[model samples]
Target: MSKKITLFAKIFSISFLFMGCGMAVFAQNKTEDENVIRCGVGLLSQSPTIFTKKTVSNVSVTASCSDTTVYQIPVVFHIIHNGEAVGIGTNIPDSRLTSQIRILNEDYRRKEGTNGYNTDSRGADARIQFVLASKDPQGKATSGIVRANGGQSEWQLSEQAALKDKSNWPKDKYLNVWVCNLKNGAENLLGFSSFPVNSDLDGLPTGADSTTDGVMVCYKYVGNSPLSTRYNLGRTLTHEIGHFLGLIHIWGDGFDCTSTDYCNDTPAASQANYNCNTTYDSCPDAQGSDMTANYLDYTYDACMNIFTQDQVARMRTVLCGSIRRKTLWSEYVPQEEPKSVSMSLYPNPVTNSNVIVAAVTDNADVTVFNAIGQKILQKTFTPTADKITINLPEYQLAEGCYFLKVVQPSQTKTFKVIVQY
Candidate 1:
C-alpha cells in the first residue's frame, strides 16, 4: 500500500537545547536494568498470537489500501505526583507535557525536517494524529491534563491500577497516559502500555479491563526536557503509544529468530539492542538487518526513529477494529471547542487537476504553499450559501508536498496536501 501523507497545520519546530544535558543522574541507586529495559515485560507472557494474528491479517487485507483518511485521537495526561507543589517533583509543568504531545504528532505523521523523519524507504506516515482533549468527561472545559497527588512516592508496575485509579478519565473516549515514578521491583522502569484488548480469537467482543487500558510512564522520561536527559526527546511515550496501538517489540520478545513481530520489513533479532548500534544484526538468516531504528525496539531514545509500513497498517487496524478505539475517529463525537471548519480536497497527489470542496461559513480566503513555505496559489471566495469549490490545475503546481491554509471569519485551519504526477 502506498502511504498517504496528510499535512495538518504548519510544521512544528522542536528545540533541542536540552539534548546536551546527558543521561538522568538521580541520587537513587541504579539497578542492572539501565535506561533501555524501561518498557514492561509482563505483556510478553500474554497470548503470542494476540500480536501476530490480528496484525498480520489486517496488514494483508490493507496491503493495497491507500490511507487517505486522517485519524485524530483525543489524549488526556494524568499527572500523578507525591503531594509535591506545582512544577516540583513528579508534577511536571504543562509546557513539558505539551511538548510531548507535539512530538507524538510529528513522529506519527512524519513531518518534514523533524527528528521523526527517516530516510529509509520503509518509513511511513501513520496518518494518525493526537490532540489534547479540550473537554472533560463531564463535558466541562478542561486543558486535558489532570493533576493528582497519589500520596505515594513511587508506583510499581504491579501497582499500575493504583496509580491509574488516582486519576483516570473514560478510557474509551480518551487516551489516558499516567505520568509518575514507575518501578519494576527494585529497578526504575521508564514506561509501559496496555494493548487494545477488545476482541477474541473468534472475533467476538471481549473488552479489556478498563482500569488498566492506558499507558503509564515515569515522569522524568515524559518529555524532551533537561530532566529527561538520555531518554528524553519524548520518544518514550511514542514507543509506549505504539504498544497502545497494537505494535509489539521488533524482536518479537524472544531470544530466537523463529519468533516474529508479524511485520515482514523488520528483520528478526535474538534480542533487543540497548544503545545506538545500527550495524548489529542478531538474525542473519532473516532478510535485511535488525531494525534498530524502529520505535518498537529497546534502542536509546535519540536513536529510535521510524515505524515500518506494515507497522502503520497494524496500528490503523486496531483503531478501526477495536470496539472502543474505533469511536475515537467518530464524526458524532464533539471534538475540541471552537471546532475548525470542515473541508475536503480530492484526487490527492493531484494527477491532472484537483477540486477542493469546503464548507465556508462566510467570506474566506484559501492559500496554498509548497513544502518550504512558499505561497503558490491564493483566492478569495464568498460561499453561495456555505459551500465553495475551487479547481486547481496540475500545471500550476510542481510535484511535491504542499499546505492548504483556509482563513475564515471565525477561525483558520491548515491542511497538508501532496501533489504528484
Candidate 2:
C-alpha cells in the first residue's frame, strides 16, 4: 500500500457552524497502565467530550485567513505536582516538556521525517507554530516550564478551573498548558482543552470559562513517555490543541451517522477510533472511510498524521476570528526571536541515491545533523535558485533519522529526515 493513506478527494460543502465553543476532553489510545484516561471507553462509559450545540453562520472560513502567514503562538506550561521531586511523577523533566513542544511543532507544521509528517493530499501544514514562552507574565526570563506544588496527589476533572487558577497566566497573552496528576477515582483523565469561540459577532459562550481557557494534559501523556504506550508520542496535547484552536472530533460524538464536524473535507464517522484501526468505516453513507489518520480523531498517536485542507482553513478562521485566539498571536513581546523565514524538505525517509533537497525563498544556510544534534554537514545558499540540493553519500551516515536545519538570518526551520537504506 502507498504510505499516503488518503480516504477521499471530492470537495465537501459543509455549513460551518461558528458558534458556541466549549471544552473537549479526549481519551486516546488505551494503555495497560494504572493511570488510564477513560474518555468514555473503559470507565467513564460516556461521551469523552461534551460538545456544545452548534449554531449556523454564513461566515466563510477561507475568507477570514488566507495568507500563508505562519502564526506563532507563545505557550506556557504549569507543572503542578504533589511535592514530588523535579523530574519525578507529575514534576516532569525539562526534556519531556521540550519534547512535547517539538511534537507540537512537528504536527502543526507538518515537518518532514516525524510521525506528524504525512503525504495524504488531505493532510496540510496548519501553518501554525508553537513557541515555549521565554518570558513570564512578570517580564522576567522563564523557561516557559513553570514547576509548582499543587499540594495534591491527584485532581478530579471538576477541579479544572481551580488547578488552573493556582498557577495562572493571562489567557489572552499565553496559551496556558497544565501538566499534573488527574487520575480520578475509577478512571484516569488523559487530557482536555477549551474550544475557541468567535465572540466578535454575537456574544456566544465558549466551551471554557476564563478560569479554564487553556489546555490541561495529564502528566503521563505530556511527552514521549514509555508508560503511556498507545497514547505516547505526545499527541494528546496535539489533539487537545486542535480543540483549543476550534476543531471538533472527526466522529462528531453526536451518536448518529448524520453527525458532522463542520469540515467538508473530513468524512462523517459514527464514533471515535481507537489504536490504529484505520480500516474500520463507521459511516458507510459517508464518502470517505473514517479519518482514522486525522488529528481530530481518537486514533493512536502513531496512527494519525493528517488534518485536511478544510480543517486547516477552519482553524485559521478561528484564529483570525475568535476573540480570544486573535490576540494570542500578537500578545507576547518575545524573549526569543521569531523565525522570519521558513523552508521545506523533500524525499524524507531519504532515498537510496541520498540526494536531499531544501527549498527556501531567501538566502539560507543549510546544515544537517545526526539523530543527536550533531552538525554533520553545512552549506550556504544565496537564492541564486530557490532550491538547494545536497548529496548525502559523501557523509556516509548510517540509515536513521536526522535533522536538516535551514537558517535564513533571523529565521530558522528544521526538517526531520529518515534514512531507510
Candidate 3:
C-alpha cells in the first residue's frame, strides 16, 4: 500500500503469462461497461514455438559489452488506498516500501532473498540497481510514495470509479502504481500495467485507469506478511515493471501460446497458470518451462519468484536502451570502505585446492568468475572462523588469474583469484 496505481500496472498484468485473461479482456464485467481482460488459470498447457521471435532493436546486444559500467535506477512508489493508510502516512510504511524497493533492486541486480515456493535453483540477481526516487520528473522533492483517499472502495477499480480523470497525477517524472480493491471478473484482479498510450504528448509512458492499470489488492493482503496473501507479493510489481521495461509474457495471448511476448529466450507455453508445479511442463517440446519462476508468470506470489538470465538480459536492454533508466543510478554512492569495495583472495603464488578469503563480512555471498566472466563457483557464506577455505578442486581452473567477488545487501567486493590447477 504505497501510492497510486497507474493504468500501466493495472493493464500490464493482463499481458502476463498465467492470466493472459487480463483487464482489457476482462473489462466487459465492470459496471462502467469498460474493457476487461479474461482470466484463465493454467498457462503451461500451451504449445511451443520458435524462441527468437522479437528483437529488442538492431543494437540489442545480448552478452556483456566492453562497457563495464553498471546501471542504477530510481523508483518512486505511489500508494493509493481507501483505508487509513499504513506505513506511517507516506502510504505503505517506509520499512515495508523500502523492503519492497530493496527487493526490486536485488531482483533487478540479481541478488537473493527469502525463497518462494516456485523459485528456481538458479539464483539470478538482476545486474541493475534501484533506489527510491528523490526527485520527480519535473524536478520536485518527493517522499517517493503518495497517498489519496478514495472512500470505501475495496478494489482499486472502485477507487478509480471515484476519480477517473488522468489529470490527478504527474505521469512522466513518476511511475504511478495505485493499490486498491479491484474485481475484474471471476477472480479479483491482482494488478495491471501498460505503456504510454500517447507517448508523444508527454514523452513519458503514462499509465491511467487505476482500476485497470495499477495493482489491485484486498486491504487485508497489503503488508509484508510471509505468505498469507499470495497475491500481494511485491513481485507483482516486479512483473509489471517487466512490462514497463517492454518484456512480454512467455505465452502469447488467445488460445495460441507460441505467439511470443517479443522477448527471445523465454519458452512458449500454451497458457499461464497459478499452480507452482515445476513438473507441470506446459510446452514439453520446448527447451524449458515457460519460465514459471519468472516474476511475469501467473502463479501465486509464493509460487512465482525468479527472473531468468535471458529475462535479465532483456531488462538490462530496457534499462540501457529505451527507459533512460541509467539516470536512476545517479544517487547510489558506494561507501569508500576498501573491504566493502573489494574482496581479497589469499595464497596468490599458490598451489592447492583450498583458497582463503580474508577480511570479509560474515555470511557473504561469493562468486568466482573466469577471465571471460563466466561464474564457476558460487556459494552463500565464506565461513568466518579461521581462514575461509574455498575448494576449487572441481573447475580445473587453469593456472591463471580469475576474479572473486563477495557480495551482500548494499555492498559488493571483488578481487583476484590466482589459481594453480
Candidate 4:
C-alpha cells in the first residue's frame, strides 16, 4: 500500500508520466530486531507519474470487469546472487520457487479451502494466472528461471536499472523479477516493481520499456516458510504484481477521504494497516470500512485474501492497453499444474515400507534416485482414486536424503524425499 493510486486509462502516444509509486511503492522498510518483525513501503523518484496522451473517453471496460477467461502471464525469475550455492543464501531452490508459484495461482485464482480464499462479497477471482516462461527469448527451452552471479553482496533500490542488467529478458516478452539481497546496509527490503509505461507514447525516457520495467524481490521473501511468519505466505510478490498490473493501494496512499485508488468497490481507508488485525475502520464516513484484507493494503500475509471486481477490472484493462504487458501471455504455452508436483513421504525415516501421498490426477512414471545421482528404483504407477498412496519398499540400503522424480507426458518434476532405516 505504499504507492498512491495512479493508473492510465489509455495507452496513448506522446504523453509523459510515473504512478507517484505511493505505497512508498518502490521501497520496503525491514525490521532490525530478531524477535520483532515488520516492513514498510516508500515512494521513489524514477517512478513514472502520468501517461495517456489524453483520456480516451470512448474506451469500454465492460469486457474487463466481467472477463471470465483466465489470462496466463509468462514470468521469468532472475536469481541474482554472489555465487551462492543452490538453496543457500540468495540462491533459492526450485521447489521454493514452485511453492511461490503455487501460492500465486491460489491467491490470484482464490481457490476455495486454501489461504487465498475469502468470504467477502467483494472478493473475486482475478482470473489472471502466472506461468514460468517455458522458453527463452532465443527460442530455447527454459524453466523460466534465470540464476546468475551479480558480483555484489547487495543491491540498492535506486540501482534497479543496473541490477536488472545483471540478468534480464525482454520486458515486452516476459515479466522479469529479480530476486536477490535487497539489503541497504543491514535492512532487508521486501521488493518493488516499476509501473508499466504506455508504449504508444513518444519522447519518453529512452528504452523505458526495457530499462526501468520489471520487479525486484528479496530472496528470503521469494518463497513460503513458517520461519518467515510475518511475510511468510508469499503475498509480498502478489501485492507488488498488483502494482505491476495497475492496482494501487486501497487507502489511496493518504489519510484524506478525497484520495482514491480509482476502484469504486474498495472502501477508502485513512491509512495503511500492516498487521493482521482487520476490524479497524479508518473511514467510517465512507460506505464500507477499511478493506484491510485487500491485497493492495500492506496487511500481513495471512490477512490478505481478496481482489475485488473493480481491482480485477483495473488489472485486465492494463493488460489490454499497455503495450509492454498485453503480449506477455504469448511468451509461453500454459499447462495444467504438474502431477505430483509436491510429493509427501509418510513416516520421516523410510524403512522397509514407504508411502507416497499426493494429489495425482493421472498416470505418471516414478523413479527414486539416491543422493549420489544413481537411480535406485523405477516403476509405473497409476492412481485409481482422488487420494493417491503409492508404496515403495526399498529404503533398507541407506539412511539419508533421496529424491523422487515424476515424469508425465506434459512435464517432468522432482521432489525431495528422505529415506531412513
lDDT of each: 0.72, 0.71, 0.51, 0.68
TM per candidate comes to 0.67, 0.67, 0.55, 0.67
Ten contiguous residues with the weakest lDDT in model 2: 8-17
Question: Cα deviation in Å at residue 302, candidate 4?
Answer: 0.9
Q: What residue pairs are clashing in model 2? A: 21-207, 22-207
- Candidate 3, 228-328: lDDT as tens digits: 34554566666667655545566644334444554445566645544466655556666676566667666555666677666666555545544323222
Candidate with best lDDT: 1
Ranking by lDDT: 1, 2, 4, 3
lDDT of 4 by residue, 1-421 (tens): 2223222211111122143333332222221233221222344543333222212222224345326567888889999999989878888888778888889989988989988999888888888888888999999999988999999988877667778888899988888989987854455677776665662222112224457688788888876854476788898889888878766667655435555666778886655676776676766677887888888887788889999987887787767767688877642245786544544446556566756645555677888888999998887778656334557664455767888787656456677777665
What is the C-alpha local distance difference test score of candidate 1?
0.72
How many steric overlaps are in each model, in order? 1, 2, 66, 19
Model 2 regions more than 4 Å off = 1-35, 38-62, 199-207, 330-421
Error of 2 at 25 (Å): 10
Q: What is the C-alpha RMSD of each candidate to the true structure, in Å?
A: 16.4, 15.2, 16.5, 12.5
How many residue pairs of model 3 clash at the backbone?
A: 66
lDDT of 3 at 98: 68
Give candidate 2's error at residue 360 in angstroms: 28
**Predicted candidate 1 versus true structure: per-residue lDDT over 106-182, tens digit per residue:** 89988878888898999999988888899998999999899999999998877888888899988889999999988
User: How far out, in Å, is residue 357 in model 1?
Assistant: 34
**RMSD from true fold, candidate 2:** 15.2
- Per-residue lDDT of candidate 2, residues 1-421 (tens digit): 1112212110111111122211112222222334355242112222233333332232234544545778889899999999989988889999888999999989998889998899988889988888899889899999898888999888876677679877978999899999988755546777877767643321123444666788888888887886677778899888888878767677665544655566667877755666687787777766788888898887677897888887787777778878678888852233676544356666777766645444456677888898878889888866546666667777888988888888886568888888787
lDDT of 2: 0.71
